[model samples]
Target: MLLSPTFSILLLQAASSLAIPGSVVKRADPVVQLDDTTVTGIANGTVNQFLGIPFAQPPVGSLRFQLPRPLPSYNESFPATAYGPVCPQQAFNLTIPSDLPAETQEVLEVMNSGSTRTISEDCLSLNVIAPANASVGSKHPVIVWIFGGGFEAGDPAATDGSVIVNKSIDLGVPVVYVSINYRTKVLITLAFGFLAGKEVQEAGIGNLGLQDQRLALKWIQRYIGQFGGDPSKVTIWGESAGAISVALQMVTNSGNAEGLFRAAFMQSGSPIPVGDIAHGQVYYDSLVNQTGCSNSSDTLKCLRGVPYDTLMDAVNNTPNIFSYQSLSLAWLPRVDGIFLTDDPQQLVLQGSVADVPFVTGDCNDEGTIFSFANLNVTTDDEFLTYIQMYYTPGASVDEVKQILDLYPQDPADGSPFNTSDQNALTPQSKRLAAFQGDAIFQGPRRSFLQQRAGKQETWSFCNKQSKALPYLGSYHGSDMESIWGDGAMSDYFLRFVTNLDPNGNTSINWPRYTLDSPNMLTLLDGSIPLQITQDDYRVEAMRGVSGLMLKYPL
Candidate 1:
């Protein structure tokens, strides 16, 4: 059939609008075909990206809080140029309270910088970055990064992968990068994936965000080759909650990788000792009542129907990680009887972790940044309440008293660990940091390594470089700059992804962590830095606090 004159003219006008007067034509949109669907992506310099590519159907309507469903076969074209919106996040950096110390204020800036402001429910997407030379013929090893925000917020869009891809290309060890987004802090200003109630438990749909991640891995397995990635060699890496997420993924299937990934990298986090979903019944109930879903036959479905803004307001008004019991995040992933058969600590004890080569480490002062939010707890009574509320509520007064004795009141014995009285923002600030850090980050990581030492090759590091803000010495995420920048840490990471060992071409002797000699690579900011040191510091403190984590997890 011949096109009408009017229609032909319209088509020509549309084509002309896309052309620059004398610009040299380069190429059509970067094209990729998965199974049968054609995705037209963006080509920028030496990095080619297919962004906002859906790895699973949108989790909305009837699918809310349910396990992600793989998209069926398709023959349509998908425009993969821009990033997908992130999952909902609380409006960040609104008005800051003025009384905070200058250092604490500075710490907040970096922590808030990691969240992407734009958000929507349709955020289950992943981005693929490859070297310009990559194609079906060049199967390069892959690096998959997961962002962290206390399981309350995070956005893959907040970070750039071109840096990694370009660094790999520069060092002559090109690799592909994949970053993904998942629902977090559900019903809150954002959505957390693992909110559970009896209604949810019976349905077996908790941990929706993690399900989103596993689906992305499956997608990579099915189609990463089209973008010149070796799916079999994918290494999962993350920092903070993302790091905790990496550890959780290891134990989810009783250590069964299911051929989804081969190795792991964690920064400042670990498989926490969170209890069953029933522990979160209060938050679920609060959400249901606030969203006016109390009488609804199916509360989860009722939540899906509530007005978005209304539901967000209710969730936001409730207790959050920053509340009095700082870091006791109520909306975090818990043992839901499905994805997690039991508490992760028990799983680790049962040897249910993947027997893969891994690296796990922490910043010099992982607690400083986290402790900034609890500057209000200055007195001994407040401190006791904090311990009961966040650490061991059921513990008798003697247990709380024992915790105080172990942590002590002296700033030097506290966090920003060797800084002495310098960063004592409050009387109890340093003490709180010390206790929280060991309970949440340091202790779990050390325990994780000790449990896996004889079974797998593992390396640990302590980042003292980029020790930002005076008080928050090498605080949580202090290593991020080096990890993403073309710095030593980044170089080591590239080497690790390219060849499962981080000591690829360096003379630096990074040793495997072991029970007999628990050595860690100390990354400091000076020439001749990066020393191999023993993991003996804080030994007594960690041992003293280990049982608290086991009894009452945050």
Candidate 2:
């Protein structure tokens, strides 16, 4: 029998109430007694006493690439009052444009400044926040957030859930907010290197980062009820690579956390083709060659013996590591025949996904952040050369002419194309942006929705607000403003999290997406409020790209 949304919701509700068979005692401050560490936090009129807890054993030294071991049972209460260390990452320096206003500049400075922001391998931890009046029977819905940094960089602590938590409390719908950390960079993707010649692949090797997330969910299932959250009503949310992870969890059977989570929110990340075992083998060989671990000794052991900094240096020295246009990075989830059995896009096409309610969308200018590398284009000829060289491989002169004809150049006017094209591009740039956006984001999004449309409950959105930034044009990570907004948007996210709807009673009709007539929720500027429309150009482009994907299955 086919899975039904009603059945899924009911199952989750039932799972939330499941407790230790006969324990009946309830407490007002259950977290204080249950966790060894606890600290109070206040922001935006809401008070959150947090508990820092370990969900798994530290993946250090010998356990580096192995599956996560369950956290040791602590007999005494532990203090989880402060944020834990961030996962290891290469130091990144982002330059704020001189055109930014002083206030915006200050905000950006605070967002990026900190010597403590340096990466470390010893960074697997979780943070929990609850309302001041949190109790056992309050049964607040829980949101487990996973941050995104292209599987390379990000910190759970960087995102402040105070706004969302505060808004939830004010609306009489309290929520427990959680942010978790997992291994990053080489630690995550290099597991494939260790699997060579092994008969059975370990659970953590190819996608240990994902395994870490699942372990955290299991911990939530076992302990969240004691902290005023309904364990069964957990919702997993993420952006960028985090969003891709969410999509992975939805499709992978290993992601079946039983009754832990019921809903998912994916922002700016969708499942694309992942590397296959054969391709993974190539990456593993490259790592071996770069690190001088070519000896007959166990490759995994040799890798573990190398100093963390040395390994990082080797990764940095590699040519074109994150050059997405050339697809050179090796640190991505792989189809290792274990946690991930098949490509996610193919799974979606076959309607093989967890039949749960989903809220998914992309920022207006997702491509712009990536297009920074192509900024040297000063003329139409330069732009066309880039397209022929990077986008379509082995295209002859005739094909290039056809593509140019299809997307003509207008030297007179410049307008940014897609959500990120606000600075004005030549007509040729606009067309290139559309094609690139389709190949990278919009196409995948449409294909994902179409595959899941008739099978599950789906909601779609397009965030189209510039918010004080002139040229950004709602680029990547903009919807974060709504989810963790300063005021109004925060309230909207709170309402949506507690009750599967974001609009208040007086709000306009917000309909669910359907396969026959897909409608998208547009969050635009002005007092116009939310609106819906059905334009399937992105979807059509995806169908063509999907055909191309068959030729090059990652």
Candidate 3:
């Protein structure tokens, strides 16, 4: 029975549904030995699992604030089962949308029950999941996932890879999955981890979290073979700050992946136009002042010496994505002369992006949830103050007016896309949401595609299935359910991982993104009605926003 390509993909999806993870157990204990040290992992029917494998030495004590150090060996029989402690981070809470359906609200409760979780500084670890049949006789392509929280928050424990691995087995395109954890916020991520002042910059160390990711990739290249993964075939993927990091990794070392990864995938982030390391002086000063290291001759060394709790106390006092700044998060990757020599946008313009096949996309209303904190802003004057203080502070009055004019103040004109007048929380709420949706996520993504399409095989998408969450239409992180669940997005991802192209055998062909065509595959309802439409949402308005970004690179 030779099924056609389209029917074959559909049948494969059906096969995946029947064998959902944990439904059956074929193997009990699976042992994978690396350099004479044996780490034991469990096995479900379809995929073998290895969790909490140390890719790097725990960055504790004197290693605080330094780049990740690769773990030397795993010489003993270690049980790799439960998750390690997540990176230390301030507890984040979201004000649930009032109009959410009872069912949706219930789901949120289940997700948030573990919101109050513990974390530790000893958090550099990774997890791997492979098809039960993977081996040297069957080297599966590796899909390494990097999680996102504006680079200020996120833990690798949040993502599970069993379904995707199972999807591959059904499709006859088996692959391996890996998830990683690095530093974030002041603990060791965003630009905050690589926080630099005049002294720290002189020492030439920044973007430490990104460096941690790079080290993890190197680890994969060296050790994934032991778990039936191909070292030469790797795709690094992420969303938001993780997406931003994916783009940064594409451009780092002048777009040379250093033989670590061969492809990239992103969700709602691009090579952001952040200024050099010195711009983060305020946060660095606040950290030094809080930790009583302001007077120290070597603040970097002093930070390394401070107790974890003391350092975390000062870090928690800092503003996060939920603060008044909103999507204009202060703690994120920046141009460090070491990791990044110049502005990432400039680097892209100068043809600094990786020459690899990649997929990048954004949700329809990326800023709705992120801008919820700034809803109190009402009048035009306050809006101008916000633009000056957070987004593009140096923007002249005329430029700020230009941005406001483009985004507008009408609820219909703002995000939460199809909703007419229901989401106008305040006079300026919808307007701010519109601007942020474009500036942080949409604008950069568009420019990156235009600049890099010709240089590489690129694909793009826009997730418009808002899920009817009041004002927060297809908000940030909305694509996760479809991509990770049993939907076309998940199928597309399985196909993409199988053959670096989402349209490998699916009926809905995803065309390569190019400047001439300028089309985007739209994920709506995650059904057959999913569209491949023009990428012309808000062209002129977004163009103006990109111009303003030069003067104020957030």
TM-score for each prediction?
0.92, 0.80, 0.92
Worst 10 residues of 2 by lDDT: 1-10
Q: Write one digit per residue (lDDT tens) for candidate 2, span 166-249.
A: 667777788998888877554343331223223114333667788788888888888777667898788888887788888888
Worst 10 residues of 1 by lDDT: 1-10
Write the residue-wise lDDT of candidate 3 on 1-554 in tens digits: 00001122234456755764555546767888888888888786678889888888888887777778887877777899877777776534445567765644543333223224468788888999998877654678999988876666676655567877877788878889999888877534433365766666776668888888899999998889989999888998887878888999998888878899888888888888787777778888888899999999988888888887787778767776667776665567778887888889888888877788989899898877666678778988888888877888778888888877787777788878778877677888877888888888889999999888787889999988754766666777777666665565777777786688888667578888999997788888645548899788789888998878865776
Hey, what RMSD does candidate 1 come out at? 8.6
Which of the predicted structures, 2 or 3, would earn the higher lDDT when compared with the native? 3
Q: For each candidate, how many residue pairs have backbone atoms clashing (under 3 Å)?
A: 7, 18, 5
User: Which regions of candidate 3 are displaced past 4 Å?
Assistant: 1-26, 93-117, 187-192
Q: Lowest summed lDDT over 10 consecutive residues: which window, candidate 3?
A: 1-10
Model 1 ranges off by over 4 Å: 1-28, 91-104, 113-117, 187-192
Evaluate model 2: give its TM-score: 0.80
Better of 1 and 3 by lDDT: 1
